[model samples]
Target chain A: MSSQPRRRRLEVEQIGDVTVVNFVDRKILDEQNIQIIGDQLFSLVDNDGLRKLLLNFGNVEYLSSAALGKLITLNKKLQAVGGRLVLCNIDPQIYEVFEITRLDKFFNIQKEEQAALQAF
Target chain B: MPLTVADTMNYPRDVQPAVAANVTISSDPAEARRIQEEIERHLQARHVSEHDIFSIKLALEEALVNAIKHGNQMDRTKKVYISYQIFADRFDVQITDDGSGFDPNEVPDPTAFENLERPCGRGLMLMRHYMTEVVFNQRGNGVLMSKVFRRNDNGKK
Candidate 1:
């Protein structure tokens, strides 16, 4: 493996037992990047064995369906393990996307980070 | 003011909308991003409304992804042709891919409770909702979409 560390797709933090993940990129529209994000999120559970995950969308400006697909999969993974995945700080415009696809109803979306921390 | 983007779809050759920012590229995500940013820059330079820009950007992102990934299957050998016009009042773009097309209607309603968790198929729905017009060619490999800038009587966004 190359000694150089790979660029981080997510900035993860431990808020109590919840893993808070903030995106490093504003636009989550790239395919390969989205795939990497999914893998990293999966490892947070599969490798780290963490239960509750909180995704902070504070840095995300735009995200495509591919990104949504990853979130769905991550949500499923956490559910299978009896854990929870909560998303917070989504931009209103991006929230409209979830509303349009009705994913807003499917996923646990919180208006603020503090509220999201409590959900988990 | 006379013919809307929808009405001109079936008009004679002379009725076609004017073209701008027309280019073709391989099914590369980087190229797709570049073209998307180029159009976004044009919209910014034109003083398009923030709401309109957001809508256009979302629609364009979904459309380009569909063209490059689904239409061309991310094949570098395949090319995605893009033609667009950034009018003062509206933005229009036509993206065509060199691949067998699929029917947009065939896509299931992702909003349905059962399909909500599917993860895919929401791109087309968002595109239609955000764009003023979204029409695919008969072959279904090409998509023509438009976003009309919202203007009030005072013209203040």
Candidate 2:
């Protein structure tokens, strides 16, 4: 580890009817990040009005298959309540993962947040 | 005659010098996932960060898939060797198969124009991005990758 600070900042926050999950730098979402995201989802499970999830991976370089599995799991959880999950500002490499798995057909992916929000 | 890493096959073999550690698996695709898990666990035991473990796992999986799909041509009778090397700050892994060597450079560039829609090239690309270094040893029969864990060791998990 270098003395410099890490450029990546991963956070999951609830904003109005949507949960904004931002991932920065490198993909793989790591196990720590996955647990955090799971925690966030669990905390918001009771919010019936929480109908949308916006995953912003613009800063992410690539997502490991493990991270993709986590995302798929989260997507399924969100779908159970009539809520939807949408991807925003995804990098090409990460997008490639979705494409390879044919997950793009299953995921609502958008290039911008407003577009993702509009799908709701 | 001294047995280089290539001499032994069809059974589990330990790689020499333990620069890190190694494991061998049958060419069965079913064994791929298990061998990968074992490799990841071994690295975690050595205190490698979770992030680096993911990188190693991804790179190693890609190599193993190549070993099966391209190298051994999916022949269950053959074998594959997966080796690991752990240093003070980095880990190097290599996956070799029993089949004859091939040209690494001949591999199509995943980022190139026509190859955009192809599935195979992307694995090599992902391996390159996730690892600090990737090489094809002189034998041209395997892939070698090293990853330097970039974790901040502030005693923080």
Candidate 3:
């Protein structure tokens, strides 16, 4: 087995029992990086046993449907393991995408990172 | 003859060609990215608002992905053709692919409780939500989308 560390697209930090993930300052998230982001988030649950997560979207301006799909997939996986995932700091314009798809109701969305961390 | 990017710029904003380049690209994601970047550059030059640009960019990405992934089925031999036009107040795009198309009516509603967990179908939903107009060709192998800029109360176009 090769022992090279995997390159991470998401910045992950551990805060008490919650894992905070900050999306890179990329304008768009689509097929090109969805898998990389997904794998990294999944590992937080599968390998690190970190179930409670806070996803920060402060830097992301646009999110493609594929990226939304990946988020749904990750949310389901985390739920299956009795974990929770919350998102915060979504751009108002980007939040409209969630509202349009009615995904805002499915995911726990907070206006601030502190609120999201406190919600857990 | 297809209109080139240069041709798009020469015509007055009101008389810009309705059909932009009808580009044919292989089923590569990089090609999709290139086309998206070109469209972004064009929109930026036109001074589109950041909010409007984000919406258009997301909608365009969904259309391209649908055409390349579902329409072409990731077959490198297949090609996706995209046509777009830019105006001072509106941007229009259309994408066509070579694969067998599916009925848009049959796509499940992603927002429904039972379907919320599914990862697919959100692309079409998003396109319809973001664009001012969204229309699929009769065969479902093609899509045309447009976004009109929102004017303030000043009545500016």
Candidate 4:
């Protein structure tokens, strides 16, 4: 049986007590890529036992609805474990999406990496 | 069955002045990226603004994903039909899939306070938010969306 190819779409870095996850580049995160990203984040929480996470959207120009859904899922997952998820450096276009959906209220969105880390 | 403007046009010369294309893709999620790239090239050729391109791209991806994943249920045997057109001031996209259709009205509002944490209907919300118009067929197996460009101070379309 052929196995599914394992690909890492997010870069994880440790800063103090928080894990900063940076998107690779300014590309659209579609359904398939969102699934890959969700799995990686879930593993970081479940396997690596990370408590706080900061998602850096500096290079992410666009986000599909599926990608936003994945972020919600990650937020709930982390919250259930008493952990927190902070998002930072969101592109204005992408930020408008969060505003339209009212997700901006539900997430801890910051303007910069320093602010996001400080929030944690 | 794929829906096309040519299906209803009786005269060749009556066709609208727009760039349009149609394709049938398998139920693979990866195909969405390729479709997005191809559409981006077409939009770029027409001098669409980057902001408008990003909005159109988001709505396009959501519609395509809904058709392939929800409408077709990721059945490899089933195919998703996508058609798009770029006019001078607007971009139009249509996506259809072969599956048991459901009413789009039944989708709950994701922005509601009680449903804030839920992720089920955000795609449709985002599509409606970004697109100038979003219309679903009565059967709910197909969706048509359009994004109209706003003129800048220079009166560019």
Q: Candidate 2: list runs displaced more than 4 Å.
A: A1-108, A111-120, B1-19, B151-157
> Of all true interface contacts, what fraction is found in model 3?
0.88
Instruction: Give the candidates in order of lDDT, highest first.
Output: 1, 4, 3, 2
The TM-score of candidate 2's chain A against the true chain A comes to: 0.73
Q: Please give the distance, in angstroms, between residue A81's alpha carbon in candidate 3 and its true position after superposition.
A: 2.0
TM-score, chain A, candidate 1: 0.94
**What local lDDT does model 3 show for residue B63?**
86
- What are the lDDT scores of the predictions, listed in order? 0.85, 0.66, 0.81, 0.82
lDDT of 4 at A75: 90
Q: Which stretches of candidate 4 lie over 4 Å from their true place?
A: B1-15, B153-157
Best by TM-score: 1
What's the lDDT of the predicted structure labeled candidate 4? 0.82
**Taking candidate 4, what TM-score does its chain B reach relative to the real chain B?**
0.86
Could you tell me every candidate's TM-score relative to the true structure?
Answer: 0.90, 0.54, 0.89, 0.89
Residue A50 of model 2 has an lDDT of 63
Please provide, for model 1 over A1-120, each residue's C-alpha lDDT reduced to its tens digit, 9 standing for 90 to 100: 225355778899998988899999998988888878888889899999999999999999998888999999899999999999999999988998999888898999999999999987
Which model is ahead, 3 or 4, in terms of TM-score? Answer: 4
User: For model 2, how does the per-residue alpha-carbon lDDT over B68-119 read when each residue is reduced to its tens digit?
Assistant: 7678888898888887666556676678888897877777874554544454
> Which order, best to worst by TM-score?
1, 4, 3, 2
Candidate 1 lDDT over B1-157, as tens digits, reads 3233345554233344443766989999899989988888888887778888889988988998999889999899999988887665678778889989999888888888788788567999999999988998878998888877898523435
Candidate 4 per-residue lDDT over residues A7-80, each given as its tens digit: 66789999989999998756746555667778888889999999899999998987877777778888989999
Tens-digit lDDT string for candidate 3 (A3-84)? 5355667898888989899987465565757777777778888888888989999988778877887788888888999999
Kindly report which residue pairs in candidate 4 clash with one another: none
Listed in order, the DockQ scores are: 0.76, 0.07, 0.76, 0.67
